[model samples]
Target: MAECTEESTMCDPRHALLLQSVQSGLPLVHRPYAELGQRIGMSETEVIGLLSEWVAAGIIKRIGVVVRHRSLGYDANAMVVWDVPDGRIGDVGRRMSAFDFVTLCYRRPRQGDAWPYNLFCMIHGKDRANVLAQIELLAASCDLTDVPRDVLFSRRCFKQRGARYAARALAAS
Candidate 1:
């Protein structure tokens, strides 16, 4: 990969346009990269090369889809927070993340008496009862039966989209 610098990422006009096109999400079609290149006056190879360079240089952290679970028939979305022991959080988190039902799992710092939970995981299901059952299974599998935790279910759906770095840059220009 070629050396990546601040100027390489930001000074290139083509890169700027490419970033803007990607911000809204890649086109839903075969050969999306090629399509994006055509739109930005680049070849498919050039588009891939720049994106790869950005990822390798840490300019781009991740390239992934933001799934709308509700549209996929997953209506019961719950975030389960656990007050795991500090020393065992790593192991516990790994175990929790291994379950297929658990869509997301990570750790956070506890606040105070009002909020003592640290570990967190998101579980999406077709219904509340299914989600609750999966949580129970998770507790048993991770040996977190005695752990203090809470399940906060979603009351409403929110719009989900990718970051708009290029859009903001264009607005500022």
Candidate 2:
């Protein structure tokens, strides 16, 4: 494979336009990429192919549907926090993010003595049983059996809304 260079990513004018096309977001259609292609003057295949290449090159970290769970019948969500070592945090974080049940996973800067946990994952479900089972499975699968951790379930969901990259997203359900 050819090396992905700084110039290819940063200096390309088409790349900038392409990024902008989706910055606000692709049209809320059945085929978002096809709509994007039509607007950007590229074939749907070309658009998808380029995106696939970008993902392979790690230019795009991930493509995911960000659902506002509380609005979608998920009543309980646990913010599972881990006090993992700095050296192993990256490995642990990646492993934690791999779980399908882990809806959101990221790291936070440790707040010294007040807060010791660095890595965090959000697991949302209708009840605690399913969420707890997922946590157990995650711990075992990721070799996090004895890691220092805490599970904080949400008492209330004060804010529940999907991310607004575009002005609208179609919802037929």
Model 1 lDDT at residue 41: 95
CA displacement after TM-score superposition, residue 47 of candidate 2 (Å): 2.9
Clashing pairs in 1: none
Residue range 26-86, candidate 1, lDDT tens digits:
8999999999999979999998999999999998878896778998999899999999999
What do the candidate models score in CA lDDT, each in turn? 0.86, 0.76
lDDT of model 2 at position 161: 49
Best by lDDT: 1
TM-score for each candidate, following the candidate numbering: 0.75, 0.59
Please give the distance, in angstroms, between residue 22's alpha carbon in candidate 1 and its true position after superposition: 0.9
Which residue ranges in model 1 land beyond 4 Å of their true spot?
1-17, 28-31, 38-41, 53-66, 165-173
Q: Name model 2 segments beyond 4 Å from true.
A: 1-10, 23-25, 28-34, 38-46, 61-67, 87-91, 94-99, 132-148, 154-173
Which digits, one per residue and each the tens of the lDDT, describe model 2 over residues 22-105?
655557889999989888687889788888887999977777776667878897889999888889889988988887788888
